[model samples]
Target chain A: MIGTLILVVCCLLSTERLIIHAPRPGRLRTPDLITLRSDQRFAQLKAVLPTTGVLGYVEAPGTVNAAHYYLAQYALAPLVVDYSPQHALVVGNFFADSPPDLSPNLLLIKDFGDGVLLLANKDVR
Target chain B: MAVALAAFLCFASGFALVSLFSSGTVPDASAVLFNLTLSAGFGLGIFSLAFFLARIFAISNIIAVDAAVLVCLIAALLLARNASASTNLLMFSPGADEQWPRWLRRILVAATSLALCGALYAAIMQALAHPQGGGWDAFAIWNLHARFLFLAGSHWRDGFSSLIPWSHPDYPLLVPAAIANFWTFIGHDDPHVPAAVGLLLTFAAVGLLFSSLSMLRGRVAAMLASLTLLATPFFIEQGTWQYADIPLAFFFLATIALLAVSDEQSLARGSSSSGFLALAGITAGFAGWTKNEGVLFVCGIILARQIVFLRAGRKRSEINPSFHRHSSAFLLGCAPVILLIIYCKHRLAPPGDLFTSPASMLHRLLEPFRFEIVVKAFLRRFFSFGGWLGIPGTVLLLAFYFIVGRGQRRGLPAGHRASILALFLTFIGYFCVYLITPYDLFWHLRFSLDRLFLQLWPSTVFLFFLLITPQKLPLSSNVSR
Candidate 1:
């Protein structure tokens, strides 16, 4: 009897949580913009990048966490996006419109716009 | 349409495989539900294996391969169907004793159906809200791997390069390969594919729990057990997150259920068919293919079976060679997937993150602080893991279990004993993994501890129901072994 009561209580609690956590109808209508922007931001870069191989990645400094790095990696899969600028070819991602502060050994190869820059490691070759 | 077709193919393939192996003494309706639930996971696993091997062999046209495999499975299924009529396998009688009153059972059934509707609503809403799937892991890990497998073409091997360690290139490819296989059929990566897969697995897990319980326990017990799972809000949320944990949990639950049924059949007829054990092995192997933790599960279950096998042998004062045969059948089922995992580890994927130098690992293991922290975290998480609204679910279940007594009259059946022991061992393995974790102990636990628990949650619930009931519910009415 107590077991059944507990099951009843659990069911009620779950229903409550379900209602609380359910997304609003309006919210589902919009495209997931952050995901879209992330995918689109790297679209051109992906086209130019080699089909396979490791490439160095640099993002805006404070945003050096796994989230942004993994997002970029997600956008450019099959191409290993190493979270470092030591490779011969580096992909520079900056949030601001201006040029990112690059290390002296890194040379700008091309700016594909949208804060996505290609850099060549002068120290490599 | 492509997603639907792929899903149908997977379900069909799994149904055929399940029908080929499983026959029962349970009623036809219950058997269909049980077999269908198992088919969902099995089909997905089959696709994962087939797609992975095709990629390994550079067979880019996965559609043809899938279709071919489907044809072969159906043919074999037909043969098995004909052969089943002539076979004599042990079947257990369903326990009709102590059934709940009709009115109460109807109330419970009505309550369960309502809860199911609510869960379905929440899951669909969750999927709609995040059409791209949930959280960072959805995009970063599982989906990213799928994109690699689907888009990288012949160069898919590049995704496993050591250069990108954060994406967990070492992780198994069940989710990714299955998603990629569907994408290949669709001619593009539809984000809905993963979402659909996630939703399919989540409900399949629920369905498997309900159907298995219905067979093993009475309808009332089945409804109550399933209600507990459905009430766990976080489980529904996590399932929509498009992660591999739910799939892992499904396989875990499936393995235990199969073993329990197989053991019951053996006890009834004084013998066993290799079919059920073989199917259990396949599920265990797929568990390994689903996640790294699943590999640990495979080990834990094997150790569990060995312990049980030896005990039963000793009790009989002679080792039953049928135990050896069962074990071999299990191994035979596991062999194909295990070999694939070994190949992936040795030849394709980067080294996993958990292990480090033996000296460093040992030193970490010796740290008293780490042990204290992990224990406290586990204890806290144990009570709160499901993100219940009030009076956390686990605590309530425990309270109920104790108040009603442990149902210790028969002690645990041998299969349940092995399964419970396996889960306990798996928990120990998780604790040990935390002790020697290479990452920040806090971060690792924060990110993964709840998920790890969730992986075992469904099985734990099923086992709990089985224990509390303590009756030998009929597994099947006319079920084949």
Candidate 2:
């Protein structure tokens, strides 16, 4: 009886270990505006992003006016804009129209999509 | 109505028989009735004892305490009458004249008293710590209904309105309504009061069951069973939580005891045993009213009893007549509770969605299978040791298996065999019900399966101890073996 109990305890402890060591499924990666569409470019850009901060994305059909207003309202993260000829100069406009209350950490990077661009925290790689 | 009348008559008759046969001293019919009433009063006294203590400690409201006390008193009285009938029937067995040793009797009584104390202490301590809702069912269903009743007030009927979509409108309201009536008298609609009262009733049922089973069996069985139940992690935890599982378990055990008595009487000739059969039916009916799974238990017991009767009647001529008569009496006694449940479900509350919409019910039933949910649930419920029985029960079960053989051994009498069979059937019934449950079986099993087993813990332990305990030792033996 003592031997059997010991065996049972050993088996249970092993099962507990297996449960703890099981691999978890990966989460979906949030899109970054400044990263290029190529897998390698996106990977490189992802590495430079803040490890702890959230990645915000905006997708709307209308003009950039509404998107700009939403970005201003929720200004915690920099806007990610799709790489496009029209959005190339929008980085300058973002820097010019930046709210005085905006943290100095907000840094406008390059665009990734048609009109999408990436913003980064100044401390990020 | 017929069922209620039959149950009342059976109880009345059992009281008379107990009065007649008690210690070979027959009291008058009036005196018997008075004693029966007194026993009921005693039951109420026990309830009041617990309630008053709860109130004194500010653990429960006076109104909730009073209602719980009253219900418990009534249930205890009914159960005690049943127990007396059971004891008398056991005494009529051929070898019953071989009186129990005086020391053994004293040990039995002391052990039973201690078990009752332990169950009471555990329940009270749990309730004091978590007064409002200790069990999950109490929060998810029973107390939720109480909350609705209190909040809805004049529109309390609205509480059962199917418009809510989430609440089970068709569920019976006997328990919640009783609490609502207390709230009405106090002119204060406090949901906590009803929830607390429900917890008190749950504990009272556990106490009475443990005490009664102990008295019927022996002290050792009683102690083991009570300890198994009180120490069961889930049951003890829920004893503090407000849930209907404990109450349902109480009613389930009451029905099992009733059936056991009836079965015993079936074997004995010239014995007046119709009362217990009816009482068992009534208890089963109440069980059905308590919860949906209770209806399954009622079905299981009825089917098992019918099967037993048929088999017995085929072999013996004398068994035929009593089987028919007793079966009818059982059905007659069960009629009121059944009707009450039907009325509450169909007329008072909304129609059952599970059956009415076949498509929906089928969808729900098949969903568990699709996700490997039932397998997961079964494994979890079967292997988990955190229930009312806790570590002690696991140890006892392990010891029981090692000490007692696993397969068929033929030393036990027919009566003992039948009792064990009935217990096994009841356990299987609970298991099968969970396997097919439409709700989240995992959550349901986690919260309830253990406590449900605790309902039969006492009876199982009693049977176990009786079987495993050494009958006699050689006079010349040096060691205690």
- Per DockQ, the best of the predicted structures is 1
Question: Among all windows of ten consecutive residues in candidate 2 chain B, which has the lowest summed lDDT?
Answer: B472-481
Tens digit of per-residue lDDT, candidate 1, span B1-481 = 8767887888888987886776433345666688889999999999988898899999978988888888998899787766666332333345542555667677787888888988999899888888887788888789989999998989898878777767788999999999999898889887888998889889998898887777666666678788889988889999899889998999999998888767766765566677878899999999999999999999999999899878867666233458888889888888889889999999998778888578899999999999999999999998887988877778878877877645444556566788999999999999999999989999999999999989999999898887787566334434443
Please give the lDDT score at residue A36 for candidate 2. 16
Q: After superposition, how far is residue A97 of candidate 2 from its true place, in Å?
A: 32
Task: Please report, in order, the local distance difference test score of every candidate based on alpha carbons.
Answer: 0.83, 0.46
Docking category of candidate 1: medium
Lowest-sum lDDT 10-residue window in model 1 chain B: B86-95
User: Across residues A1-125, which tens digit of lDDT does each residue of candidate 2 receive?
Assistant: 34223323332333233223222222113222211122233433444554222243332323344334323211211222222223222221132222223235545576443333455555443
Listed in order, each prediction's TM-score against the native is 0.94, 0.57
